[model samples]
Target: MVNRTNRTQPLSGRGAGTREAIMTAAERLYAEHGLSNVSNRQIGEAAGQGNNTAVSYHFGSRATLVRTIMAKHGTHVGVIRMRYVKAAGDSTELRDWVRCLLRPVTEHHAALGVPSWHARFAVQVMTDPLMRTLVEDESLTRDSLCLTLQGLGRCLYDIVPPEIRPARAEMARHLITHTCAERERTMAEGLAEPGASWERTADALEDALVGLLAAPITRH
Candidate 1:
């Protein structure tokens, strides 16, 4: 699905710098505060723009800015997932496919170092009434993600009933995004567990997601 948001011409020089600064500031602010709670004027100010309309001038609306950030990070995560997908390679083991699903996002968070906000930012986007639709539109278009889903489906085709697959997949999504957000918040506040790390989180998520996807669906 093409992003229907308003597009700015490819920026150059200082214009590009300003746009990036605004996105960086917006991501951090939105991650810290709820999306609706943060204003474009505040985003511009945080970007160090003297012009209060900087966000509007550059990205137009909060939705467009959010899309831009999601697209940027989505591409990075797609790249990582593609590599993981290649490694999984026709493996029938459920855990291999589960790793393909969970590791890329956690690995990206690990690479972002401490004080990163994208995970938390994603939680807000995924949960927000207005922005939630954008997640499926943006994410479903990725080739790597498509392949991972296909592989996961093959693994679960016999075990998990078709009707409950969607619910389990949603559960997996919530588990990954919210847990990562919590970990990011913990680290940002200097309250992280001693030796706690994204790698460890990925390990745990892989185990939990495998169980989720492979569990039997009981009819009520």
Candidate 2:
């Protein structure tokens, strides 16, 4: 008997490479074309795989494919972020905290070739319910990223209200997300203009975020 479902099983070696190709292409296309607009067939084509069934085999559905992509990138970025966050000593300032939050994504962008449309794509994915749930599940485990956030919270314990620390942390996360979206957009637009270095963008973003997150502390 032939196992028709064998193609759907997890790939390894060269097969793993092929699956990664599909995922990378899907991410690029979905980020470029938007999730709703990009189809399984389109993703397969972009991935250089002739079979549309690869998407089903690898991810089960279009929604799952997008989720997988988000999970891959989000987890990678989150791990790098948590390293910096967890390493900060007792003397970490608000700006150092901001750097820990901001550096991973910017550094990745600098290395991974920042997309011209990533800002808009980020805004969409962050706001989308399905994607948000996927992100929360894949990246924000209590022992992982959440613990890092709690550490930051501890650093600011003297300045922030104990009762509202969770709320403030949530707000800070949103502010970082939205600010990154805007920075990506500004970079996309400003790349053709003068003085568009990633360093400059990172600095400006860090300044803006420091203002947003630290303002409350100053008021207190």
lDDT of 1 at 219: 71
Give each model's whole-structure lDDT. 0.89, 0.67
Measured on C-alpha atoms, candidate 2 has an lDDT of 0.67
Write model 1 residue lDDT over 32-90, tens digit each, in one string: 89899999889999999999878888887788899889989989999999999999999
For residue 70, model 1's alpha carbon misses the true position, in angstroms, by 0.7
Clashing pairs in 1: none
Give the residue spans of candidate 1 off by over 4 A.
1-5
TM-score of each: 0.95, 0.77
Runs with alpha carbons beyond 4 Å of true place in candidate 2 = 1-10, 114-121, 142-144, 162-175, 178-192, 216-220
Q: How many residue pairs clash in model 1?
A: 0
lDDT of 2 at 161: 69
Q: Please state the error at residue 71 of candidate 1 in Å.
A: 0.7
